[model samples]
Target: MGERAQQIPFYCDGSYLCEPCAELCRTKVQRQKPVKTKAYKFNYQCQCKFMRGGCKLRYQGEEGVVLSEEERSKQKEDYKKYLNEKLLMMAAREVPLNRLNQQQFEFSLESNLENAMLYDDEITRAVALSCIPPEIVDLASNPVQQLKELVNWFKFEFFSWCDKPPCPSCKSDQAVERVGSDTPNAEDREYHASQVEKYLCKNCKTTVRFPRYNHPMKLFETRTGRCGEWANAFTCLCIALGHDARKVLDWTDHVWTEVYLAQWERWVHIDACEPLFDKPLTYEKGWGKELTYCIAFSSKEMVDVSKRYVVDPVLNRMRRDRVNEKWLADTLQQRREALWSMQGDSQAQFLRKRYQIEQGHLDAGSAHKFPSEPFQPRQSGAQ
Candidate 1:
């Protein structure tokens, strides 16, 4: 039964891997080379796809198959057709998306405005300013690292407010398991849908509900979730810190965050669950699992950053499915331009800095140093 199940590619679909199975998933490509595959989703489900059917988790499968020139031509043609169709589909949906976008923008920018409002007030404003790091301007130090530290601070101190919502009736430590049912809200149609965490209190028999809120600020108040809630809360906090941080969604059933560290001129990966910062290789190297795609989104832009997550883009590109790469690129660029048009000249400079980073990844000729932070050579190396 286990072997049969393994044949079907789960593709990081809320699966958990035990340690032995996780290690097994980390197949050795060559004795000298290290493993690069992630095998766990928290402590619950295993994402182990050890040489099964094209190991959908890592995009690792069927080693010897090679496409002919004719087949390559067909793929190129298909990709182009896909891009065209996708463009049309996007265009058709823009009106509805625009409405949704406006709805989002209304409640969204309020957070920014509220911060500014707090700044405008004399007393509350001063209190908020107290959290600003005094050493933030020290260019000698990596601001990216500082921002990461800031994220860790928020993760530990602010957003992850409690482990889980305490049982309302009795404040019991024992978790009430899912005996579920709840009314769906507007967020189900607007953003993402989540299973309502309904738990019946063992002690008092009172029902407790944890509605998956899509709003970042609301999440800040609620603050207890798996990766999804943490990512949302942390992204909001990053924005609160006056940085271009984003919620990075991995189609592999995981969500994390990325912050655009101006010091390094690249996005630094941060996962609040593991409470990790700038450790992109934690999954690839430590967990020994491969990733397919991690698309980062913001109010201003969206970019496919799978290249920034792995050691070899070519090897791991196999994990990407359901969409053509060209289509993906074109779609992301279109989204950026659309959002950019809305911002006008206000954010031109910020967008340009961000665009340059995106463009760097697009240039096929350049070597991709996967998931590696740019290194600074010591100034007095030979001195």
Candidate 2:
């Protein structure tokens, strides 16, 4: 019976200990170990999959593969050598001969203008005419005439004051008086200053002041303005006329205009604020040259004369102001030298490579896998 009972399985009958096999069976199940995964890394050279490309290259670590201090030092030295070689090559390159040709052309043109045997009118006409294309001769005799037509058109269209009939808005019948005409011999500076203070805008009938310290703000308030305002307005107008003009900034950052003269093949300075017809008079006290004023388009002679009166503030600054071109060049050279020295240092190269690795530059296949430290096992629960 006992042998049969052992062969047969026993059943539980509402008791703490059920069948013998059931009491012998283990309740706690062991957990399966987690599968390990491969880590990814980056490679700097020939970036490709190692297995597919038949590359067995391994990254020891960021510290091991990174450029060493010695290597960096050598690289820097090589960089300096490369820079010097490049600089020498640049020095060997010849400047184009055409540069001298341009300078010579400009010099000759300037000389011809200064010492020309022709009368001022003839010279101006010739230069102005030369600016016009041969195809356009039938339409206009010269550039000057074309410019006059353009100015007339501008005056008629944009500047209502240029229209032959006075504008109805400004009561154009009121005589347009040239301010400083009555005081021809008076001090120009004092006279111009006074006129600016008393001047009023014809359009808005607003009082305008020639800012003593800065460029005029309300330059376009009227059909006309004081000499300073006129100069700026004319400069802006010339730009609107499809002419290249820039405001000149001088020692005091004094404002003026430079106009491209097609005939002269260069920029010419002009001040419209000064009377167009006035000739500069020399002061016995050496207070500088006196400015003469003239009417706009008084004559071709007036335009030619005005050309001589213009000055370049930049040229004047270069001549009179202090500059340190050599010092600047030397400082730049020193900085280049320092950079080269650092690049050639092996230590720097090593540090740079390490930095790149820390910044994730290594390849995925060769990346290091760290082992986690074992944790303390818990004691068996109290019975």
Model 2 TM-score, all chains together: 0.24
lDDT of 1 by residue, 1-383 (tens): 13222212223223434333433333443223223235433323344543334432343334677667786677557655654454444333322224454444334333322322222233432333344455542422566666666666666665553334568878764866557667656764232334456677777778877676555544544556666666776665556556677777665556778877676666777776666777676666554455777777777777677766666554455445445555556666776777678787868667967678666854551324543444322211010
The per-model lDDT (C-alpha) reads: 0.54, 0.31
Compose the digit string of candidate 2's lDDT tens values, residues 81-116: 654454454433433445454455334323322222
- Report the Cα lDDT for residue 132, model 2: 36
| Per-prediction TM-score to the true structure, in the order listed | 0.57, 0.24
Model 1: lDDT to the true structure: 0.54
Quote the lDDT for 319 in model 1.
47
Error of 1 at 182 (Å): 1.5
The segments of candidate 2 whose C-alpha lies over 4 angstroms from its true place after superposition are 1-142, 146-218, 250-255, 275-383
